[model samples]
Target: MQFSKSLMLLATLATGTFAHPAVGRRQATATSAAVSSDWTATPSSGAYSTAGFGSSTSSSGTGVTYEGNVGNPYGSNIIQISSSDASQYKYVAQFTGANTDSWTVAIFNKYGSDGKMDGWYGQACLTFTLAAGETKYVAFDDDSQGGWAAASGSTIPTDSNGGYASTWGEFDFGSTTNNGWSGFDVSAIAAQNADMTVSGMEICDALGGTCSSISPDAATVNNAYTSAETDVGGIGGNIASGPVRLAVTIDYSG
Candidate 1:
């Protein structure tokens, strides 16, 4: 289904202006890319499962868990996504770190930005390391296929008082870990713009070593988040000046 022009205009307005550089057609290019996508909440029954770590406090009594020394003083844990429709939209996983553990995200897309997995587009993944108890907004832009593209003229909205939003994603495994992170808002956009089929989504300790693609449904599961709002297309915030933050995640099953 196609999105309305009014909505497109609204999305453009929310991101300042759509005056992109004249270098390509109507598509997602490094110079003319839309803001990160957004999504709605999914129903309760379709949530997936997770595994890899325990919920108990870590050895340092930091109340965090460690999953195989990915760098958590607590124990270890991870969240997975392997849904069929997961490819139907773009997705971003949002997180907030508590201690000095490096955080990062990994991604594997079936279809690259222009539709090829190994094609060159733009920045496909992003990582953010937080200071002890620092709150910030970290978004993962996967539309770029040409290695790591930079997000120019884009800004992460801070709180009214200019304080960073206390949210982060993925943990320290470094960029080579193949598990880049995406924010919840960006996922909402991907779900609408492209036909991306996702096979793996995970969050683990980056320092311990590396992790493999486990099932989205694992043991010791907690709460999960998904979106039921289908037919999501085009940029979000079409009716407002600023984008609304949705701090939620969910497991998907094929």
Candidate 2:
């Protein structure tokens, strides 16, 4: 993704020849915050692959690469924070492909009584088309609710309450049509919480045909923050026959 180019475009779109101080000032604040932070790639849950760019995986965990065969359902555990105190973090989901297919990504946040992993909340949903060999990055902050952006180092726009919960978050990828082969190259998470000990991380899979039945892997990621290149979709090049709900369980502590 062309971070500088996209920022220029965003500026041009936000303001014309005449600049509004109020709007410009707000934009400037957001831009500055995003630019100030350095992003670290999260480790992969499975085996690591260098076929894609933007993120890397570690040796201990495995990575899944979702490519080829359209209309299949794929999901990944994007962020999993298990801290006693409130923590702030950001998740980056990068999609890279060489096709002109439209894809839909649904973000699910685990919620319930005391952040128990009892229910799942649909936080944000996004759909976009990718040109051949195009790489696009979407980011969301746990503290800011459902803010998302296309450029890396770009501040998340605060529109909805996407605040972080004491649970797991996931990204579900699928095609809008049966066109075939949408790519999800990277699944990365970055924690900005200060003085927080890195406990564990792992790749999880949500299976079944309904939202309530979806489950996650019991393992945790061994590293602090890392990226994964895992293939999270249906088997035999076919999409799941029924409603494949992507949900997570939250277990918050007091």
Clashes of each: 57, 34
In the range 1-254, model 1's lDDT, one tens digit per residue, is: 11122121111222221122222111122211222222222223322121222232111111011111111212122223223222212222333333333333232221232332321122123323333333333222221111111111132222333311111111121111112221111221122133222211223222222222112222221111112222333322111211122232212111
Task: Locate the minimum summed-lDDT window of 10 residues in model 1.
Answer: 58-67
Q: Pick the candidate with the highest TM-score.
A: 1
Displacement of residue 24 (Cα, Å) in model 2 is 24
Superposed Cα deviation of residue 171, candidate 2 (Å): 6.7
lDDT of 2 by residue, 1-254 (tens): 11111111111122213211121111111222223122222222311221111121111111121111110011122332222100111233433432333322234322222232222223333434434345444433211112122211112222123332211233222221222111111112211121112211222222322221111121233211222212222211122212121222211011
Q: Evaluate all candidate structures by whole-model CA lDDT and list the values in order.
A: 0.22, 0.22
- lDDT of model 1, residue 193: 31
Per-residue error at 232 for model 1, in Å?
A: 20
Candidate 2 deviant stretches above 4 angstroms: 1-90, 112-125, 142-254
Candidate 2 lDDT (Cα, 0 to 1): 0.22
What TM-score goes with each of the models? 0.23, 0.22
